[model samples]
Target: MDADTADIATIGHRIRHFRTRTGLTLEQVSDGVGLSQSQLSMIENGKREPKLTVLQSIASAIGVDLATLLVAEPPDERTAYELELGRAQASPLYTALGLPVVRPTKGTPTPTLAALVGLHRELARQASKAIATPEEARRANTELREWMRARDNYLPDIEDLAEEHVKASGHVSGALTHREVSVMAKHLGFELVYVNDLPKSTRSITDLENGRIYLPPASIPGGHGLRSMALQALAHRVLGHERPESYAEFLRQRMQINYFAACCLMPRSAAVSFLQEAKKDRDLAVEDFRDAFGVTHETASLRLTNLITVHLGMRMHFLRVGEDGALYKGYENDGLPLPTDVTGAIEGQLVCKKWSARDAFTQTNRTTELYQYTDTPAGTYWCATQTGRGDDGGFTVTIGVPFADAKWFRGRETTARAVSTCPDPTCCRSADASLETEWADRAWPSARLHAHILSPLPTGAFPGVDDAELYSFLAEHSGPLGE
Candidate 1:
């Protein structure tokens, strides 16, 4: 059969399966769907193609989604709907409800579409359930960070999980090899396939039922980076995260997978031993960790932050800044002053140019570490920064600690000291005198609008997902909400 005909037949089969599974007779389902028994029979027999609305009604009557019925197999419907619902819950209206969204399981019966609509109606009647705010993103970050801090940024459970995985793979204490990743994928019944036509934001897509993972080669770096990315994808399946109920939960899930990936790349015991040995003579350098673990600078810094904060009892802040001095990413369990928006967001805000995180951009050598001491309104902080220019752009990674805590770091002896008066109008390091005098009339740098910054505010999982796509999703699911 042609693919379209086969699809219709499959959808028809699903309708019948769900109808029988739910123990609804043709007459009963037809009555609920506003269709006669004969018409319903025709649809279930694949004689006629149901319209989208008709399909939705059928799905609702059967306590499922239209997309669920459209899947080739009923067993896979749960997974597919979960993936879609994950994106759907990111909508501001759903998020504002603050209800824990649950995915329907085979054993747990879902209410019919009408019942769910009634529930939504009751919720709306009691009080409006919709409140959209940009600060939701900030709140998510704060929640996840607080969770990380509560555990002292150490995840023993995930580390144990990774250790078990590594033991099963017959590999001990080192970066996972490409051959090992492939072996692990096969062991988990997954076939790895590479493609080039994935969305720019997507590095990989997993099809659990099909036991396939689609990796976009161009997006993934080579060597150890590739192995790390592959292991991360496998880690998601191994960890078995449910669909996230909130943006904060989504961030937490991502971080969990990240921690798992880092553990796989640099096993915790070995990393700790190495750090302990290295710290005996010299302060910890991010590059040393990167080289030892065969990971990138960002990965190394994150690993160091996790290791020191959780294992060593040292609280520090990590930063990634672009050449333009925009804060790309940051995490702090330490009480250090970092840049923030009015909403207290760290990402996308401009870092103080005098800060080591930004000043490293001015250094000619991108690889060498640039350490500085800055006295902000909060307190003096010593930071070690290194810049790297890649094909994409130039960016710097910095690890900083409060001045009182700087004695533990290797770069604490650097004479590059700057008294930064940030977030204060009367601060000594204002750009007005030097920068304006040198190029006020010459440089006309326009403020750039980065849509990705706002994209994460609405979407839970992936940044840069167009808002219109999310709007369309809401419109499609409007019937489920009784809109």
Candidate 2:
């Protein structure tokens, strides 16, 4: 059957149902509709599709409306069972076994049909469980992203929690200070302890029994990350999180702690006020937001995604694409077309070479932020991007909104622009036709595997965190602060 029309088998069952319910036999309805009994029987058996006019006449002959025969659902439990049996027989799962197809008649038992469908469902479930580790991670990320998108990526409860913690720390200022972080830790009955040899697999570890949060003495540029790390460690206790049972739960806890830390670093009320004032003046910029919060540009950009659409009514997207144009992280409520896989994950997918996230890496002047307007299949979008280098390499932090909302942003007037028909091979992904014509027959380049490509997935409740190492570090440090 054509996809546009109802499945012929189900339709046939419905017609049979209405015909029998109206006390009409095949011969009687066939004669009334000007068709032979054999032809009508073929139609009833789903061996042939009747013309629309023929179906109409049959409906009229059977004392029913034409619409009654067009529904997709099987008319009865028996009909549903018959349909599933047929589908299973036609499936590769049964056929590949070289077993005879089971054909049932009116004499077939419903219990047998129920057992077959149940077996098929279990087989499919087991098949899906064979997904690889990377695929599982991608699925987890995709689910979490959709969850965030549904709530506009804003959790008022988490926001309120962070706000309460910040207030309890007596914070009224520019950036959340290290001292304030210690105070916040203490308020939760934990003290911050600086350490030279924290566990390599962990960022900050909370000694729940000892009531001490162990952190590294070193900090990121301009002293930004320590407070967030401290708050994240404290958050595990405050949020009452247990060991995650699955990758999805682990991802949820990670995002919650990250969001809590971000809100602590940049309290929502003050951040919203600052954004509103900037938007009012049409001077909203990521650099200024980063400076105001004294946080990294990436943190400010991500935090903006949590606050902007809900508070200022502006939809935007955030990206952390690497120097090689592969997207490392992405979030969007705006209609920017990102390259996504079947899992709906944008991470590890390459963006268009022309995207600001990729192009900003080529710019010489890293001192100033890069801005550009990109014409995508979704629409035009203007983005402000800042490039920075990390231990892994260089990447860009980009925040963009639709062209209509660009007027309220500081970089709206940038002359730098490009057109991207991405997710299409012809759009920056494929080589020029002439170039491809020349090279396709001649080249056989070996691809370099990315770091994550071949690495074995880390296992445990917390995927990458080494539990034995974490416990040892905590036990060693739990004795005394100086020790």
Candidate 3:
């Protein structure tokens, strides 16, 4: 209504945001500010008008300034667009879009101010959606992953940009070299520093302000790890990845950066040519590519999948699991069943112990390859996986193709057949009778590394990346990762 009412509303909103952000309850704020919890809640819900003294007391209790509590940020172009979009989407005109109609919150709705408050409430509701509920995150991730799989996980535009950058940096094919990275870093006005103690969960930290990129010293000794790390960090800048506004946008950006890094290391044209030659003998393998190119097994495995899916037009699936058989990442276009949660997500689900990925983890003195043929409700498929350890932890990477498509790979000879009825009781791996009979209550599966797998990541972007560690690092150094 009036300026005073608007300011009171803004103060209430800010106080609520701060309290929620700091994990403080209404009771705690009320107790500290000498107000009843009901009064505090009413103020927070914009149903009660609070005095200046009350606002100041609440601000002090929340560890923020009185002015900050009263003044709301003026929405920029993007925010204004989102607010308008939310308001419009809430209307009947855009009902087909299926976004929930933001109901007007109860209070007196003055003719003119009612519309503004309705829009404001709708904007608040939409802004909260950006944080993502668990279901929202799961659905968004599944949709994005499916979208990537539908396109065969190959982004031609991103590939072209990466290839152009590589050529411009003076590298002429094969795998990208360390020298190329150094040259590009210099061109981008960056100096690389190999630090031994750069946070356990972090691989590399880019200090754009200081014009220095920090790499774990371990990445430098061998394995072309240094180049991969440098290129990934540089990809954020070269690709102009924006600050992620939501979980889905964050996942898309991370995938783009990874795609860019992979393209730089294994050029699309060169990789397609190599695959064309290598597949002639039915000998296509990640190890073969790893040796042919100067990349690690993990990189080679991902690169091969990228090429085979896009270039060869074969639907495939890739899975990465730990020694404990937890699925770290998985993608499939082939109609083969993989373990998944109730929400139909493959990630974070425990792999069927009989599956090739888990089998690879148990092999003593395991060779560079482990292959298995699995039969599921959809059909039979053949998978080849390799187990490896790294700074973060140990993991196994498996690539599977439909039975019809397995003829193109060497692992087709393996008769190690298994049937998987995943997320089903009759499935040999998940059968309670089978497991209880074998271990008889003696086995332990490590209590399921909860790790907030089902919850929305606090940073609201980058599905698997540890944004908290990066934030802590940046806070310590007084620097920002991305604007």
Candidate 4:
């Protein structure tokens, strides 16, 4: 295409690309820009060029700078090597490797090995005068990759160290809520957006070059208070390294970081050991596990589920109660059967009654039930249980662990034997029914589980730690929790 046609085509591509990336429909964009949908379509198809006023309006409507729509280069004129170099430059992995494009020069000593040289040295040289010679660059790339691998491998220990540092600085404070942390992140270049009704126990953190943003479970549709607690933990963990980026990329990176964080905090080996120790003591109790591992209750419960489901051979599930007296964070492991196909609670009332009663017991009638109270650094959990066989003959265990009064489990024996039978007659075989409707409802169990679960407690909960200490702890532990 000629220069004029190429410019128009580029503009068209930009408009379409931005619109699709932002998830805006043509009609919606057209209405916002005061243009007919057909007209917008023509412009995007490059059949016609929009007037200056129209271009300005389109840019404004789409929330993009006008220059973004105007920048364009003809495809035919673009150098293939330059494009390849561009791709390499945009990749975080490649950038971290310190590989830059190079241009051959008369007196310049080039690496004899083809793989050691970048595709476009001229572009790289123009881009950065500080780049070293070919040999130096190659060595640097190798060293950088090794460093990155080491960092990724040791992230958990690094995070623990960071957290310790923060604690020692005495900067921790209860008033430093997630919202406040989010606001601080925005000041550092992150734009926090909430995604309502997310599934339970699910969260993500995105690293957008500008900064990082965390999507707490509470922001998800079915999230509970635990979601907030998780976010709080994360805020403390990744305070210093939270960089900002564009919105979409930010969400993507946050998820990647969150997964890494989870893996780091509860490494597969540590989880297995913790579960083995807990099982040996017959103490699936949160307090017992917390003391054994020196973690908060929420961390312990999460670790418990991970252990039972991921590490152990048993299938496991979890639920947390919300303000509406309903269950949230209904999660199940791969080996177990899900009570139902839906993501939320099956029955209307709380699901813990099946195991909460004193006469309730465990069975293998394709289903087993148990009730127990768990304590965490955050609070106490009144949990109910159900286990059933899946279609493939594998077992699925569901536990509805709800936040409740800490006193409820006060007198319950930590080493109590499993009950033999469930006394509730209204219970159903359909796993689809709500816990409240399936069985005879009983009074909330008295508190039996207790411990300082919500520890390194939010700032005000402790006496000596200050904001500096809290920030320092988070920065140190930003990478991972346990090795």
Candidate 5:
């Protein structure tokens, strides 16, 4: 009936149930309890809290123990429906709608009660879902990134698993072949199947019962190739991930699978040895690393992030920035301070325009990687950014290290360098004095916003996937496995 009485609604329902079961009328119970009949009715309807003596007298009059009336569960399915309806009507969302609350009677159909309860549940779910703001998502992402950073971005256990699986696939070389990936899948009791009608929300779907992994036949732009994606799907099973219940868990699982994929493609011992040789030659280059591993530049850069610090004795930083200067992903144990929001999230925060990650977009040499040294408040750092076009737009994958470590890397002595005192607006974000004065009041520029930056992370156990669509896809595809 009201917020104050919401907690005791179940108690009211129980009292009514026990009273009716004993065939005691409201008037009879009130008479025995020495309260007005209206008072008894109010208590039964969850509109009033009867005193301890009044409750004792009611229990005595109804021939039941007080504990029985105080039990948590509704006495029956019908009472459950009534309790749910009362809760819905008492909620702030319902009251704020300014709609008349439905008071169900004995004559009200069971279907009507069921429908109202279902609608109320959906309303509450939607309300809760909306409350998961971008800030919450960023905080989750930031925390997960911090957790990864804590271990120097190296997971020896995961690395061991990747090495064992790769060796099992009979892989002893450079790039992990598609055939080797298939071998690993077969070794793990999974078969890779390509389907055109895969769910849009999912990259790869594993039907565990049927021992199949369904993927798209076509390659996705700015995404992992078939081998990497397959390895990732297999990684899920290897890592023992169930459906994630929160955004943080989802991010972690995603990172783990990607990490596993990287480790598989570039096994720990081999990749580190390759880097060691590159360092000996004073010619560490991300492009050569990408070429050697036959993986994307971003993938190579990320793999380097995992190994360079732990194995190569070099503190480093990696950044993936969009053409619009938004920092899409970043990691650093070196002192290059990434711009962070109040929540310590780096994604969606703008990288300094003076940084090589942003300036690479202006470079005329599209075929070659752009390398530069940036002088920041922290120190001078040498970075190489490779600009590429994706389905969304242009982006850059940059890997960098402190000036001291630059001696071991290629492109260490380039004339291209700039100063950045970022995390300060005047460093890059603010317009020049003449430009600001001329158009500060005249400009009414509309911001081109990314929808994901404002929207909540998708709701449900698996986060962004549609359960019904995935289940149907799995069922449709599983029939062939039996054959």
Candidate 6:
């Protein structure tokens, strides 16, 4: 069968599998689906093609996302939708929802994208009407959850496909040059008209039957560099007889292509192997790994998280400083269980603090305690840091794992400031006296503080560490590392 037909067949099989698993009779399923039994049978048999809406309904009935049904096997054509889904799957949103965000699959309709768009529209309408009722809010939240789930699943696939296509056809081949192609087209009686001053917003190139070119605003450049790139892109398309119609479409395709490239760059087997080696070496530094893999720092960091969380079955979280100097990008729980935006030294300022106090901090297998303060509007955070880096890069990639238990901080009521009472304390030092003066100056309310404290683990009890050698050492020496 052709590629598209094979996709349809795989989808049909999945639908049938879900239906069978649910133990619904053909008549019962058809009745629930509002389709004739014969029609349902034909769909299940791949003898008939179902409309997108019908397919969605069938998937919903089976308690699976529509995209899940559509993505039966990886598509041969490698479209934008596939790439977007792949990238979206890598997002923390997908992890939070407990869904398979990233997996190989053929071309499919993005249920997540459709859901997000629909939710956005609904939210806009509700906002315009000033939805005041609790019922409305609850319903909105439900729809939002569904949209989030779909977006978490589909957007990555779209990105992957687009990136792949752009890389494949946008660039001139090894022997061919843009000038040569332009000259060749002219020789074939086609006009070699170059639009150098196209708008910077141009996105895609389209070929009219009359031989006129239509380029989206986003794809065009504000100056010569972009103009050259656009011309080259257009020239490549002219030679290939293919081009995306809009900038958004072009971006969507580009992202898809990028997703595929990332996958190809970090194939599952290779990624797994790298994770095993990293685990063996106990190296968690993203920058060092990026150098080894020839990937960007950001990609390396994300891949490291994925390796530990997905492949190694370890709980990991990523924290990054936002442009606004706020806390963001919290994932998996590297022991800080608090919300991402919660203001504190440990929340957004961990890395900077580590960088500043790098000399004082010692790398040891034993748990070490460290304390730092958060600036006013938010109080100080006294937390312990667990420092470990892989030996490969001479400690270039450092993983400063933090531990904060709410109970421990709450126990130190006299020392700790509530988030509401002093949202941001200017100085955490007891000698500063400003915080004490401020406390005495204002009417201190009986405020509740959210605290996170790290629980100490037994020495030499690392989860991923091999126990056989450690046990053998203990049996022979009758003592631990401290002894």
For all candidates in order, the CA lDDT equals 0.72, 0.85, 0.75, 0.44, 0.87, 0.42
For lDDT, candidate 4 versus 5, the one ahead is 5
Better of 1 and 6 by TM-score: 1
> What lDDT score goes with residue 218 in model 2?
57
lDDT of 1 at 202: 55
What is the Cα-based TM-score of model 1? 0.64
Q: Which sections of candidate 2 miss by over 4 Å?
A: 1-132, 218-222, 453-456
After TM-score superposition, the amount by which residue 151's alpha carbon in candidate 1 deviates from its true location, in angstroms, is: 2.8
Evaluation by TM-score, superior candidate among 3 and 6: 3
Question: Candidate 2 on 379-478: residue-level lDDT in tens?
Answer: 9999998889998899898999999999998878889999998888888877888998989999999875566733545766676788889988877776
Least accurate 10 contiguous residues by lDDT in model 3: 74-83
Provide the TM-score for each candidate, comma-separated.
Answer: 0.64, 0.72, 0.66, 0.28, 0.76, 0.30
- Taking the tens digit of each residue's C-alpha lDDT, what string does model 4 give over 150-188? 332234443454344334333243222345434444544
Every candidate's CA RMSD: 16.2, 14.7, 13.1, 20.5, 10.0, 26.8
Ranking according to TM-score, highest score first = 5, 2, 3, 1, 6, 4
lDDT of 2: 0.85
lDDT of 2 at 334: 93
After superposition, the stretches of candidate 6 with alpha carbons farther than 4 Å from their true spots are: 1-261, 322-324, 338-483
CA lDDT of 128 in candidate 1?
Answer: 31
lDDT of 1 by residue, 290-315 (tens): 88878888888888877887667678
lDDT of 5: 0.87
Tens digit of per-residue lDDT, candidate 5, span 1-483: 234332467877888888888898988888888889888888888889877777778889999987777677788888899889988998888998899989889899888999999999999987675444688788888888898888889999999999999999998888898889989999989998878899999989988998988888845543348888999999999999988766667778989999999999889988998999999999999888888888998889999999998899999999999998999989999978999977788888899999999998888887788889999999999999889888789999999999999999899889898999998888988889999899999989899997787788666777778888998987777786545
Consecutive 10-residue window with the lowest summed lDDT within model 4 = 450-459
lDDT of 6 by residue, 1-483 (tens): 334333555666677767777887788878878999999988975679899889888988877888777764633323233434444554554455575444433244466554544554564554333422333323333343234233331243433432343344333222223344344334333433343333333332323333433333433433222233334434343334234442223333443333344443344445567666765665434445555545554445555544454466554344443322223333333443332222222332323322212312443432332233222222233322222333221111222232222222212222322222222233221335775677767765773322211212121212112346434433543332234
Stretches of model 3 off by over 4 angstroms after superposition: 1-136, 195-212, 218-223, 391-393, 429-446, 460-483
